[model samples]
Target: MKTQNLTVKAVSRGLTLALSTMCIAITSACANFSGIHDDRQMSTPEHYTSSQSLPAERGHWPSADWADQFGDSQLSALIAEALGGSPTLEQARARVAAAEAFSETATAKTLPHIDADNALTRTQYSANALVPPPYAGSWQTENRGLLSASFDLDLWGKNREALKASVSQTEAARADAEMVRLTLTEAIARTYNRLALQFVLHDMAEREVRNREAINAIESRRVASGLDTEVQHKLAQTRLSASKSKLVGLDGSIRATRYQLASLMGEGPDRGLSIARPALGMGNDIRLPDNLPADLVSRRPDIVAARWRVVSLAHEVKVAKAEFYPDINLSAAVGLDVLGLGRLLTAASRTASMGAAIHLPIFDAGALRAQLKGRYAEYDGAVARYNQTLLTALGQVATQIAELRTTDVQLNDARDAQNATRQANHLASLQFQTGIANQLTVLDADLNTLAAEASVADLEMRRRDRQIQLAAALGGGFVDASVAHPRNTPAAVAAR
Candidate 1:
């Protein structure tokens, strides 16, 4: 065998992207990048005590089993089903799994890697080349085997920063999944409450239909006896028709709410048929925690996810900056090349090489700078989204609380009006039986009672729905234990 055929040549060292010393010199003389720096910083939010919204209190943050607090087993079961089967939630989980995979790859980049490679092939040597013997003009079988090992030195912390960015991204994905869960549960609860309200109103609609029928029948008899005109009878008939139409609308509404509830659960329309009427009790004990706006960062999943994105992008900015420096790596390889398979196992065929390599972006015509700028832009966008989500979350909580308070007062008034109307209708009936009041007066009183009852039902549903909204605004029982920048409020940063 010839010398060239007996050994293998390996490129194990040198600065990457620079083939020779001349290339490095040329690249060094090409561009000046001292001004390319990312100086944008993330914003710190203002932290306030719980007294900003309400007085400081303990045992107010929603618990994991907050759904059960509504005192409805069916609602709990439905929420459980939705959590387990929701396609939206499943997509969120898939994103988390992908993030975890990326994290694994990033972590692997920081560690040493070793692998074995082997190959068997037949090749014809060139007859007029550097080869000197019988193998020069003949086809020969060659066997090759090698083992390689490599590790990055991470001198500029590029790999380390990349790993951190991956980990932060994974955390953000996980928090996003939690946000989906919170949203899904809240939607199901709200839809269920709507269904219940429709049922209550449906009953009222039916009652009005019956009352109209009675009035229409009385008007028919009065017209036939020449005691009332056709106009009066037709007006009563029109009222009866209108009441029946209302029942039709309410029946459709009940069905529509059921369909909406089922869709929210990620199920077919038929699944709505299995849903029973809601028997939910108000979760009056649920309230804001003592450590609010300060602690809220760790409670709301959207806010937490947004903050994690900011953190991840911040690390990416570091990684981009590190890219402007050199990447140092160590590599080693041992291999044997022999024309005869039997000689592959012999010591004469053994070959080995080891060296360190450096990869530096000496010249790319501003590619590195562009990458760094892009990373900073992404980081800034994440910061903006985090701040916006924080503002929106606090606003939602406050709005729900205010709306619930108003509903409470309105509910009380509605019940009072309902009671008074019932009394008035009862007194009107008594007067009619004693001939002190006309039938029209009694009928008017009954109509007023129906209207008052319907208003009370509507308000009651509003109150319950608002309570659910408040619970949802309170993070729907989801709390992140891993608080990012919990101590880095504006005040703390200013003090620092």
Candidate 2:
């Protein structure tokens, strides 16, 4: 009777110790809960700091068909193709999948784990063994099967905190994938614009060569008639040669840009040679809405991804802090056991057992606290990066807006020069036909007009490039899908 009382008292003491450890862990976790930094307290600006007004938008923040605004069907198609084929996007997708799988694993840790086993054995009993006399010196056969299950009590919410961290990481990964897709589309558009500019420049160089050749023919005829000096004829030949050299240089540039575009599309370099020239004209037809939302920066994928990372790290800190408590688990098993296979399934031959376990980190040497501090440091870093991305996005949009305005002024000047040169060339042509002006004057006028037109073409390309940059800065009209997790969706400042 005294032994039985002692056993009961020992069990009661164990249960009390476990409960006390659990209470301490809970208190520690709660004390650390408010340690996570909340960025939402920071004041969000109504408009870009660099600009008072943002560019006009039509339907959405950045229209879904922003590429189509360039009016180049080929460019639009190429962007679509690059998005579908680019390895960069595929890598992002794989990362997202991996993060999601990790989240599922963390969630599973919060639930019970179950397993089953079966075994058969034959053994000979020794005569001096602690067994019945009939079985002491004889061989025996036994059959057994068992099912067991175990679950962590999660008394300090450690498992739940771990699950939350994993979910945030998964969302961050998805946002990273969106960022990759945005970058790929922007690259394809920019490359296409560059390729088109090269084609246009090449055509301009060829036309200049032909015009110079025509002038050389005229100068030669004048020299043969003794009306022009040998020095003058030599000058004409030099000009023609220079024009041919320019055409050759432009051919090299065109080929190189094509190769770059091919690599971006995930195709062989030679594939770029088969691409047709794209027709792109510059104009500012797209406009931003007069009212820009305060959450515009939230649409940026980098910002969103960084925000999610901070959230994940915050939860990780909580998980680390939770480790200050004890870990408790319960397990049980029930199975049939018999000396003979025939009686293995009988109720009388059954065997069963159950157990509970508890482990408190008595001597970890400050490892858990160090890990929690590291998590806090990581959270702080993510917040800083998120702020930086926001600033960068704002600067890009403002710079692009200023550039577009400046380029518009430059375009106007170019148009005026082109018009003046066109008229001069027409007048020179009339004078040459009537023998009032030399053929040399007409050729000079032709060259000047071509130069003016090339300048206009180059400026127009810059305008198109600025438009693409602005659209990319504005997040390219991407919308985040709601995640099916604890938080449902990330906060707005870190997302859209």
Candidate 3:
């Protein structure tokens, strides 16, 4: 877009006109119109608190490169793929582009506008018109060309305020895109974690089945030798069948989760089945800071987006208020007016005019007032949403922290139980070999050990799940660099 700077005199004249119009409108409505409220509905707590044990160390704000902390190269690659290719993220980027274009449009309004015009026509005068009968019945050819320029002096700073509102909207759109990126990364990590857990469970089920087969073998030998009842052998066979069934179910789960992971990475569903499974229990442990920063709430993208919305609507309210004044427009034109094309360029055929126009809203059926009222309501709604987003972010972080701590306690207990069961099983095996324990007692010890192993594995999965949730709750290390420089997140980067 082309742009031209405004002069001091033009600016001053526009401002004077705007102020005088606003004065008249305001004074006339003094008895009927009430002023707008300055207070807002949302407030924030200075600090976050929990009803459980204090953390040994407080968590720090996540870094922009937070996904790397997971320590899984495959996961990092997957996240990058999703960020670069996901359709949802693409839509967000498109919205940012649209907002940027709108901002440019608003910016253009504050600058000078110029146009080149030209026209040629042949016409016959009407006989019954005011023109003399001799010329009235004659045909005439006319040629015209003109260069026109106009500018809306931002009187009352209305146009400038409109530009500000557009800028705020652009910022909001960018924050929204960042939010989508963060969410996509978190989803990929969770799905990958679940896929790994499914593999662990599948392995566990296989081992359980082998254990049941061994038990069945022992029971069959005992029954054939008349040392155990037929009922005992049948029970062992039933246990073996149950273990096999569980293994089958776990296989199906693994396949389903793999498909989900593939979709998250922006690939075909079957692509997940071919993906290499990352090793379990390899994720980096994110430590909580001893004291959470109050400003950490601002790190959340949705909160930032909501805040921008409030700013945009606040500007919109000003724009609406400015509408109460007259629209002051300055336009000028210089062109040649001639009867033939050959004379169009002659200096003597030139015509020129320059003037300014004022459109006062003497009567608009209260339309301007209604528009201003709507803008105010929108501004209030935006404020409330921003407040709600901040509160939700705080609550999520708090809940995740508490759950992480509880998981640690439960994991410790599970490990202890596994150790005890292992020792007990070893003693029972030794006693049976030495004829001090019955076969049923030895079998019971083995079963208990198997159960204990499964319990430990399940707890480990839960612990991993908690860690994932905590990372997401903490914004997963996303940073909004675009807030400082809109060009930082270029369309080219998003397109890639």
Candidate lDDT values, in order: 0.79, 0.77, 0.74
Which sections of candidate 1 miss by over 4 Å?
A: 1-52, 55-59, 484-496
Count clashing pairs, candidate 1. 0
| TM-score, per-candidate, Cα-based | 0.89, 0.86, 0.85
Q: Evaluated with TM-score, which candidate comes out highest?
A: 1
Tens-place lDDT per residue, model 1, 157-248, is: 88887997888889899999998898888888888888887888888888888888888888999999999999999999999999999999
Model 3, C-alpha of 380: deviation from truth (Å) = 1.9
- Between which residue pairs do clashes occur in model 3? 57-289, 57-290, 58-288, 58-289, 58-290, 59-288, 59-289
Model 2 lowest lDDT segment of ten: 487-496
lDDT of 1 at 421: 96
How close is each model in CA RMSD to the real structure? 5.1, 5.1, 6.3
* Each candidate's clash count: 0, 6, 7
Lowest summed lDDT across 10 adjacent residues in model 1 is found at 487-496
Off by over 4 Å in 2: 1-60, 124-138, 223-229, 283-286, 290-293, 481-496
Better of 1 and 3 by lDDT: 1
**How would you encode candidate 2's per-residue C-alpha lDDT over 1-496 as one tens digit per residue?**
6996697668756865766666675654432333434343222444235336564456356766788877888888878888888888889999999999999999999999989998889999999979878999999998889888888888778899789889889988988998998888888888788888878888889989999999889889999999989988899999899999999988998888888888888889998898788888673454555444345546778767876787777677667767777777877787888887788777898777766787667656667666767776776677677667767777777778788889989989999999999999999999999999987899899999999999998998888888888788878887654421335323531221
Best by lDDT: 1
What is the alpha-carbon RMSD of candidate 3 to the true structure?
6.3
- Against the hidden true structure, what lDDT does model 2 obtain? 0.77
Q: Write the per-residue lDDT of candidate 3 for residues 175-237, one digit (tens) a residue.
A: 899888888887887778777777777887888788888889989999999989999999999
Q: Which is the better candidate, 2 or 3, if ranked by TM-score?
A: 2
